[model samples]
Target: MGKSGSAGPLMTLDINRFNGVPLHLQISEALRKAVSNGQLQGGERLPSTRSLAGDWSVSRNTVLQVFETLISEGYLEARVGDGTYVKRQVLGDFTATSATDERPLETKASYPFRGLSQRGKALIAHRLGGLTERPTLFMPDVPDLQAFPIRSWLRLMNEVSGRLKGDILVNVSNAGYEPLRDAIAQHLRTARGMMVESRQVIITTGSQQSLDLLARLLVDRGDPVWLEEPGYVGARAALMANGCSVLPIPTDEEGINIDLGRSKFPTPRMVLVSPSRHYPLGGTLSAERREELLDLSRTTGAWILEDDYDCEFRYRGQPFAALQSVDRDGRVVSIGTFSKTLLPSFRLGFVVVPIDLADDFAKARAVIDRHAPIMEQMVLAEFMHRGLYSAHIRRMRSLYAERQAAMLQLLDETLSYTPPEFECAGGMHFVLPFKEGVDDTAVAHELWKDRIVSRPLSMYFSGRRKCSGLLLGFAAFRAEDILAAGKHLAGLGDLIRRND
Candidate 1:
């Protein structure tokens, strides 16, 4: 009932296209369909499992499994050393099914996800993009992987594996390790001028976790949270996910316009500030505005989140004083990250919260993720204790400073590009402001084809075109690379201005 390999035909499988399915599964299903459909005739010599695997861009074992499944289903047979072949009875099952259409499975038409608890479905059903690739940078938010101290980290990891003991292995300290929290507190006091105690510091996996914890700690559903317009989109996503209404505070050269933000929200329950060097535009909140914002928080009894995102890379003389330094009302949650300064894999960050809210935040953290890993906490604590962490910051501080200068210098060399309407004070990125009538997004698409990703400032805006610019980053770029990136920007300028 079936033809042989001598049927003189062949079928090929494609694997490069992104079907958005696992590669191996895609391969297996493709082969199964061919065999069941008789397109791959019976008794045909199949490609060597290894050969098929090569075509599929997958491993040989995966192909082997596919072959094995077909054999088990009587659709294929192995002839040992020579090769595998399709079974002669391959068409037998087809005739049995072709006589009449098989009834669809009598499974209940009820919800397939009924078994999942309501919370489970809700958790998975929730959607947020750009978390995996926030800021939409060409380089991405990760560290230069080649530069990670793998040997040192592995040594620390080995030490952890060897010394893991009863309480260390089994106990989950929801408050994070004491050494790590203390170390963060010490670092903040010395470097940031934020007077915080060890108990006031809550270790987090990353800035994201810190944001989520704060949202839960401070915001009730439908409460108002004010953030800089065209600000850190990640923070906006976190607040929105927690059911808070995010009010965008317009940012000027002096950072967020404090009085206007207060007027808009009138009674914002919480305010998020990136005072040292504001995001996207990279402008610092002027001292007057910082004080004014803190005063607003104090008067209104609203909470303040001082997101000191990358203050360590302040390219100038002295760093700005943190808002927490002037926060006598115990209202500020000072968030800082190692992801920017030392490395990204560290996933180590801390939130300096008020003493009264520390316990509650800890409880919320427990519900969220229990706590960050003790081993990482221990290694990072040791790194800081050895002064290595500070040493790295001092080194990278200068490195990013030079990179920033280089990006600016290269921009000056090209005449094609227009000067950005908005400028950064001292941060990793600067927004190139665009005119109101221009289609900034179309320009962004043209740049993508050139492999240069600059974020349109308006993409960060939630309302009408309150601000328009492009956010370029140098946080993870070397000084030389910064020059090239600027040239790329210049080339883009040539293409864009040519239209004019």
Candidate 2:
């Protein structure tokens, strides 16, 4: 038993011997709490280590260790000839109270500062949907993960890792790995028919980051930006987050209505479009409309943002060349991602900017994230160099085509009513239109209960005249899985057509 010092009695600690917690940690926590709660006052001397050890029934080394920890943390200070004392400044403005006083401290209920800024709140409010680590059946825009060539990818990764030296490791480019940029540029020239150089390609994390960067650099706040109505929710979110006034331009079989957009919001700062294949609806922009859109952009001095996403998955005739291929002036900015082609987790994408704006985009990229992961970029470059990426794309095209055919057949045989405007040539998903009175959102929620994932087409529309439908994806699932899910969907045909 240790005697009380001149400072008064040491506070009693309820140390549980039966518990799994170590004795030293419990003792240290007790002392820390005592100091924090004003039980131990500043400049007050503590019991000697030996006396404390005896009183606490712990080893002397444990007590010494605890004292050293507290001293390092500025809770206590050690003197040469004197005992350890609480630091004088540790209890600033706190009244010294007896350990026996067990009254709880009072605190204010509310804070003066607001939680989130208006921009932050708006950014979160525009979220389209939640993402899952493991995608379920019929989830739109998800690639088949199980079919990815992991062995070849691993081999390339190992090769890149082995070749890494001090110079290569330290001297990474701010824009991206040079070889990867070159590979991407070359691929775009041949595949998408875009006349791009490595310098014009600014690599980004994915399409989302590319959109965010372009919005920040190209347009000012409250500027008019036209987007396809019943369009991609992500594009809307990105534009709205940057304080752009998003104008919903309706689309038909020929893509965004250029004449309609001109009549309503003629002087838009930027126009975002998926001309190769319209999202959800899957309509390729007609050649006439494409020319008209470009001419309009030139007249209005507006920038055109072409989202060439999933253009590689076209299962029908030859896919149309990228809109950037026909750009006479330096206006169209093209962006694409590998998430739909390769893996979503890789987050590899690129933006093709005009030659004059390339340096500015690179500088902006440097400020944003420096670059994508260096090793992954190097690996991807090598993968493309060996023609593995092309091969993988070819294999996926065949696989997805088969899956899509199976899904269409299953839907035709299963459903009682005819699917409206269900002619999709090549894309990940197609919209199954419901009657005007039918609630697509309620039907989608009901499908979720049966473990069948589908995006409500109404959620994609920001305008008051929303379309009632469901977007069903066929690319990510196998034929058998599609068949299994289709049976469950068949049972809901009556519910889907009830309003009709």
Name the top lDDT candidate.
2
lDDT of 1 by residue, 368-430 (tens): 889888788888887777787787777766766676677677656753443343343456665
Error of 1 at 388 (Å): 1.1
TM-score, one value per model: 0.73, 0.79
Best by TM-score: 2
lDDT of 2 by residue, 273-356 (tens): 999989878888999999999998899999999997989998877789999999999899999899999987878898999999
Q: After superposing candidate 2, which stretches have Cα over 4 Å from the reference?
A: 1-27, 30-109, 129-134, 416-422, 495-500
Model 1 TM-score, all chains together: 0.73
**What lDDT is reached at residue 366 by model 2?**
88
Inter-residue clash pairs, candidate 2: none
Candidate 1 residues lying further than 4 Å off, grouped into runs, are 1-143, 415-425, 485-487, 494-500
Worst 10 residues of 2 by lDDT: 1-10
* Predicted structure 1: lDDT: 0.72
